[model samples]
Target: MTIPLPGLDLQQLGPEQSLRAFIGWWPDAQTRLYLAEQAVQAQVIYGGRMMHADHFHLTLAFLDGSSVSVLQALAENMADWPVPAITLDLTLRDVFEKPQVVWAGPDESQRQALTVLDQWHEDIWARLTALGWTQPPRRFRPHVSLLRHARIAADQSHRHALPTQAFVGDGVGLIVSVPGEQRSQYHLAATVNPGRAVS
Candidate 1:
C-alpha cells in the first residue's frame, strides 16, 4: 500500500483462530513521530500505558471477539473496499477520563477526509452485516489512540497542546490482538490497499 505522499510506501504486512479484530490504518512516519512525542508528554501528565509506536493506528471499526470463520468472511468482503487516499490533520488531543484513553483526532479543517471516513465506515459495517455479522450502531470518531488507562490529576481532556501533524491514510487492515511480552500486540490479519486487498 502506498500513500499519496512522495517516496512514502505504506506496506501491508499480512493473523488468528478466534480473534479480537478491528479495521484501521497505520499512518505515515511523520505522523508517527508526532504521535510519539505526544505520547511521551501524555505519560508525563497522565501516568498511563502508552501504546507502542508499531501499534499506532486510527481504527475505523472494532469487530469485538470474532471467530476464525467470521474473520475470513470479513477479509473476503474487504477486497474492493472504497477507501481513497486522503490527508487528515491530527490536532485534537482528546481524553475520555472514565475509559482513560487519550487520542489524537482530526480537527474541523479536515472535514472532507472525515466525511470519506464516515462513508467508508458505514460501507464496511453494511457489508459485514450482510454476512450475518452483528454490527451495533456506533458513532465513528477518527482518532489515533495514544494513551490508555490514564490517571491524571486534572480534567486535561483536550486541554494539552500537541504537535499538529498531517496523516495520509491510503489503506485499511484487519488487525487482531495477541499476547505480548510487555503489552498486547496488534497483528495484521489482512489488508486492502488503495485499490486491492492482500492477505
Candidate 2:
C-alpha cells in the first residue's frame, strides 16, 4: 500500500547571520513515494519519530560566526567555485544500530568526490581561520540522513529494512538559519554551479 509524505515548512532568513554550502535537489516522484512507504514502515516497526523527507539535504560546509564584512567577502569568494558534477550511488546499510537513524551512503566510486570536497573544506577552513574564525571539532563525512532519534526495540518485528534511492546532483548552495532555535527555518543564500563556478 502507498503512504502519504510528510509536510514541512521552508524558511529564508536574511543575509550575514548564517551560511552553509550544500546541494539542493529533491527526490523524484517515484523516490519520494518509496520514501513515504519506507517512512510508514519504519514508524510502525521502530516506534519512533521519522524524519520528514523534505528536510533531507547533503551539507557541504557550515559557515557560522562571521561578521557582515567577512560574510560578504566570503560570498564573493564563493560566487564562483569550480567543482565537478557528481553522481552518487547511495546504498542503505545497517550503519546505525542504536537510536536508529537510517542513512544512504556513497559507494566506493564516490570517495574521490568526497575527498576533493574535504580538501576544499580544508582550504575554506584555512581562509576562515586566517580571518580569525575557528573550525568545527568534527571532520566532514558525506551521508544522506533518513531518520533521526529513531528508538529501536530488540524484537524481530523491528527489523523492517528501508529501500534506498540514487540521486543526481549538479549544483551547490549556501544555506542560512538562526542559531539556538529548535525549529528555525533554513534559507538558501546563494547557489553555485559546480561544473562552471570556481572554487
Candidate 3:
C-alpha cells in the first residue's frame, strides 16, 4: 500500500504555493514564447501574476498533495511506463473568472487528439490508484494556463480566438511543483515515453 507523506506538503516545501505533483507537458521554446506573450499581456492589462515563461505547460493529471515519499514511490513504480507522444493543437482562449485565470485549449477540430490525451490521463490515474494513490477530485481539462489569479474585466473574460499553437512533446512527465509568490512553480521529476528511452 502507498503511504501518504504529509511532511512534504506545500507548506513544508517552504515558499511554494502548491503541494501537489502532476503529469504535464512542457512546451518547446517557440510555444513558450507564444504563450508567455499572452500571459504577459493579460497581466499587464488586467493586473495579475504572470506565469514564468519557463513553466508553461498543459496539465494531464493533478496529484493532490502527494509527499516526497509517495512521489518517489510512484516514480519508481512508473519508471518504465511509456507515454505516447502527441502534438496538441490549441486555438481558443478563455478566462475562468471565479478562479481569476486565463488559459488556452484545443478547439473542436483537435478533438481526436484531446480524446486520446484524456484517455491517457485515465490510464495514468488507474495505474496510480492501483499503486495506492488516492484519485484527484477535479475533472480533467486539457488546457494550458496563461496567467493565474488574474483580475479581468467582464468584457475581457470568457472564450475568444487565440492564435494557433502546436507542440509535439517528446514524452509525458511528472512535475514537482511548489507554491510561488506570483504563482506555483514547477519542477519536472519523472518522465517516460514508449516512443523513446526513459528520461
Indicate which candidate wins on TM-score.
Answer: 1
Candidate 1: tens digits of C-alpha lDDT, residues 65-155: 8776667767766767766656677777878766879888877667788888788788878887887777776578788989998885564
Model 3 vs. true fold: TM: 0.79
* Full candidate order by TM-score, most accurate first: 1, 3, 2
TM-scores of all predicted structures: 0.82, 0.60, 0.79
Give me the runs in candidate 1 sitting further than 4 Å from their true place. 2-16, 152-157, 194-199
- Top candidate on lDDT is 1
Across residues 121-167, which tens digit of lDDT does each residue of candidate 3 receive?
88888998898877768777788888877877775536778778786
How many clashing pairs in candidate 2? Answer: 7
Indicate the residue-level lDDT of 24 in model 3.
Answer: 72
Pairs that collide in candidate 1 are 15-189
Candidate 1 vs 2: which has more lDDT: 1
Winner on lDDT between 2 and 3 is 3
lDDT over C-alpha atoms for residue 54 of model 3: 70
